[model samples]
Target: MWESKVNIYNVFELRSRTLCYFGVGAINKIKDIASALKKEGRKKIIVVTDEVVYKVTGAWDVIEPALKENGIEWVMYTGVQPNPTVEQIDEATKMGKEIGAEAVIGIGGGSPIDTAKGVAILLEYTDKNATELYEQTFIPERAKPVIAINTTHGTGTEVDRFAVASILTKEYKPALAYDCIYPVYAIDDPALMVSLPHNQTKFTSIDAVNHVTEAATTLAASPYSILLARETIRLISRYLPEALAHPDNLVARYYLLYASTIAGISFDNGLLHYTHALEHPLSAVKPELPHGLGLAMLLPAVVKHIYPAVPEVLADIYEPIVPGLKGIPGEAEKIASGIEKWLFNLGITEKLSDFGFTKNDIPKLVELATTTPSLDLLLSLAPVKATKEVIREIYEDSLNPMS
Candidate 1:
């Protein structure tokens, strides 16, 4: 008999304490989390989201009636921003309290859901000063259980228990806080995604691709995470284009929705490195770039430069995912080339200038990106120690999309 000795290291860890309730096409499935909350006999429910998703995705309409049908009275907070700030969290938290809401349901993409997490965290953990919850060292005792309804598939915020909320640094530098991983329920629905515009569909799928790639390649990947990440990358590659080409393809949407969730779990365990660590600072500097598009623009360059750092691991991880390149010695580069080609075919271009980044801006961008506190977190696990200069190279490549 063969004996297996498995080793796990500094890969991302999801706390065993995080609770998750998952359902597909759960637009109507709000009843499950609602019932759970009601069983706890909660008084009121607060549905947090941004205004655009509220009007465009029809999530608000579907969710409102579903809650009413379940006899769960609720209030809606639709002011969550694209990148939510501390003030939005406070306002939402105040509304949750004013309505005597006993539970919170995040009902949109990452922005609303992330905002909901921040608000819910403070409601339970803070005594008088809710903002203090951002600084809490330990995971805050999860406040009211949060049920997330994902209308657009990106960020995997609904499935993952983590949240990203912005704060101001002492120098007034833009900073972010990672609160407790507290998503109690995730409702993923493909029907919710069918109406997404072409550009958003492109950017979000790229985001999912980034999740799978970053997670699968990161150090300390476990057997479970490896399986999940590989499958996610394969599925996203197959289905994302189909979804973009035929926006109404429920089958494509269904596959990508499932892919997003799987990728979410993969990264929630592997933790993001590389592109994401650097992307946050870019987002702070260029608010309109959209984090997903920024990642799409920078990913190919980052992968190309980082390949020499972890050639063996990248080769192993990509060989199975790229059938045509099987048995090739340089499978990592081949798979990455395949990814860049696939991205190009999908209408995604790599020029940062197209997205408002400039050649002259490279040095300042590198300085800012390297300064992210999370940079060390990612660098510690990076196959090659990413340096300030290497980061500038990635930026240079990204500045010229035509390259």
Candidate 2:
């Protein structure tokens, strides 16, 4: 019935083309995934990661041996920063190009993987630099293949074509998605995620929750995407707290990782909405704020604002998280309130003001959000039309969420 109603529009597409290897020992299969390129005479590869991920997780210890054992020569570009910037992308791209890497292997969370996608984009569009790439001055038709080895259970960059890179000079963060940037393969091993710090795990899990929430509520959501989004929310609601409480619980980590990948696919097809659009400006201006934290802070306001436009959709989404609350009147507000409580329980009770965002910064955030070219698609996909006033109102609400 939901499908019949939603599928009335016959002009949409969904594609999950990434070859995925999931489970306990998926990391060991990297050499097998990379061998496909090596067989085609692509011997050299670049591993894109951050310094913190490299030393903390011992990712290199597992990945390097696999590459060397399989005779795949590789170089390392470990300069990726959180909320990765164009400068970081350019730095990694230059390193990748100088080494003549035929492919890129991303071995961290979303930032490094997204940076790797940017590097792969430049590898093909040799004429374009990171600035031009983020500016949309050049549309790439192809890129060197990428292998994503996910170390965090967030961002789903491992299996999605989308990549978000920040341009600090412009005070903008743009999410770039093209067919060319999709990783050819992905490896999701829960063992790799067992040691994730509580803060990173908490925020990243929230990021996945944000992905599903936005995808399910976006105007572009199809019946299929909603189903996936619903399942993602269910898994996260049940498993994320357990994962946070017991970091070594591989079962919890696996479900969260599974939920994240499903959410990524859901959003990749249905797209995101104003919540993501609003969060981008915050992270772009204050690159230190974790993306999921910003999302958690802004989500309740965005949901409340958009609830009137899609009451049925929000009701369906909330039913799984807060059982027996679906048929009640004002369910949207209840859901919004429930989300705030959940975030507070997870230790994300801080407001935007706590992060140095004063009311004076509202105008700048609104301007950047409204003017950012990359967010046009998501803005259009939002259930409620976000004008400058609406965006400012959301930012103001985020300033004191508890109130």
Candidate 3:
């Protein structure tokens, strides 16, 4: 009898740079972490964070004591802004250089972590400014080591090798993903997250869900990414409400942190699509609007537009949240509506109008979104191809979701 032959041809890869520590007192391990990484003789470091985080959480109180004990001299750069701008990056970089900093430790949410990554890049490519750096006109061969301490369970900037910075002169917020930009290590302490304002908690949780939803439905999604995304969705769906209802609940906070980390990893591997594309322009144009809030407002509209293209993936995404909803007629709309309701229950019922956006702003938003170079790639990965007209329609729908 002749033997049978079989051949398989599927290839995929997942990459993560940060070694993550998660738990109640993970923040206390900063001393040991700094000691281990300091073997390279880089003792002087800069802690990048925002003034609000530094003051409100007293993250510096926890981090500075550890660094002092470890004999790791440090300076502070608390100039990071929400949706960090290139000017902030330049300012922080200049401070880091002035202090003779060797490593950059980010101690806040995405903005500070991203600022640290930008500072790291600029530290190496000393000749480049933020504009040149973001324009990809001067790419550094390597960045100074970055250690991220996450205070928010959003952005996943802690574990991923991507940094989003706004170039205000150009009115663009570009996401820079380079191997060197990844944090050397990440500390995610749920205790740090417990004090988050209720609104911040709600927005960040929704942001994590958006990450998983976009990643799971994108063309780049693999079986591995799907599995992670599924678990992330389930975890956020179950625990976010609990965390909100009982702010002191450590278990809920831990699961929310886990969900954020897993979602970050999944989307870092699979990438995101229209929801991110739409939200970026919203924030770039109106710098005060939080990224997660924009995503929450636009997600349902974007999902409805894309449902015709990736109904199966969308159905699977919602199935974990709304058990037994898949395989039913009009399930996609139901899922989208359910998500909107869930967000509403969490007190995130604001529309674009609440953020100073009107129908008159739609065209400009559509223009900004469509012209974004990265958005072309994101839209390409989206299950549904979004033209400027379609993007405009999504923006219009987002302005009045109930209509």
Candidate 4:
């Protein structure tokens, strides 16, 4: 899809350390990861998860058996919820410390995995807690090794070095990205993903799409990022609909899983900008809001704002979804409105107001976007810098129907 790219001289730096396995039967490899840990005399582990996904995905069927056979005793911490909070991370960290679990396994989507990342830090820095980890001043350089068993098709926290947790009292959702959080092992089994609910299939897949979009256009954009982003967009555009129609179709689930994985890798190297920087605030203010929905709400407006600065990159990556308009000039609003409609067609019919936000909330969203810990750093990566006024415009433009 990035046929127009011709920059051969821009320097690139790609980074990832996780040993990841992908396929229908890859979950069994957890046996290998666990057995190696057992050899190291590490017998205790904390399984961080939201209660439902672990069992519903049948991941527990594989993980429990593997851990038991490897003589690894586990403590279960199931308090994680969507847009995981500091309180939840601290609760799990306390349980993990009580058991002296030396390593952590995260099972489920981003929330559980992100909580596990937070727990991994608090476990090593025993005196500190999740509150300190999210304070934005402490950049953790060392953490207990994490093993990620992914159950959903989006938020490749399994494969990426990013985690997020909220400080509810401060209405802050701060994301932490560090080399230390990269999982020691990552398992992405498409078989575990076929059972995903229809809404989750849509929401999670859209999150991956947003990831690729931002990766292709962020100021950190590289040929490596663009290459992965193109293939990710192609696969998701072809497969997300089929997965939604036939939730049990393994082939569709397989490609979507790969799509999400590559999308994760794309961002790991390319970084992110407006969509994520802005969406975190929406969920922080309403902690129950689905993260993908928040991204979907802001994505079109964010794209509109940055399109002029990186038109070629935006056009290249969006070709699969919006055809015949790639190289055209003066089509920012068209692409923006088209994506907004596409999201609505995928069943996310609710607007920002539908989620109880209004013009009154614009100032608050702006405040959070510009002031949230590392989010300002992300704003710096925008091709078009996100000032307070620009942040407000994106939030306001997202408040209602643009079509």
Against the reference, the lDDT scores of all candidates come to 0.69, 0.84, 0.82, 0.89
Per-residue CA lDDT of candidate 2, range 12-125, in tens?
778788988989888878768756776888889888998777666665677777677668887898888889999998888888889898999898999999999999999888
Q: Say which prediction, candidate 1 or candidate 4, comes out ahead on TM-score.
A: 4
Model 4 per-residue lDDT tens digits across residues 1-403: 3444535576777887899999999999989998999998989999999979999998998889989999999999988889999999999999999999999999999999999999999899887888888885577889998999998998978999999989989898988989899999999999999889998898899899888888888777888888888899899889988999999999999999999999999999998989999999999999889999889899899888888777777787788877767655488898898888888877887778899999998998889988889898889989897789889898889989898
Best by lDDT: 4
Sorted on TM-score, best first, the list reads 4, 2, 3, 1
Which portions of model 4 show Cα errors greater than 4 Å?
1-10
Ten consecutive residues with minimal summed lDDT in candidate 2? 1-10
Off by over 4 Å in 3: 1-10, 327-330
Q: Show where candidate 2 strays beyond 4 Å.
A: 1-7, 327-329
Model 1, residue 218: C-alpha shift (Å): 1.8
Q: What are the RMSD figures for all models against the true structure?
A: 3.7, 1.6, 3.9, 1.5
Q: In model 2, state the lDDT of residue 19.
A: 89
User: Model 3, clash count?
Assistant: 0
| Candidate scoring better on lDDT of 1 and 4 | 4
Off by over 4 Å in 1: 1-24, 127-139, 168-180, 316-323, 326-336
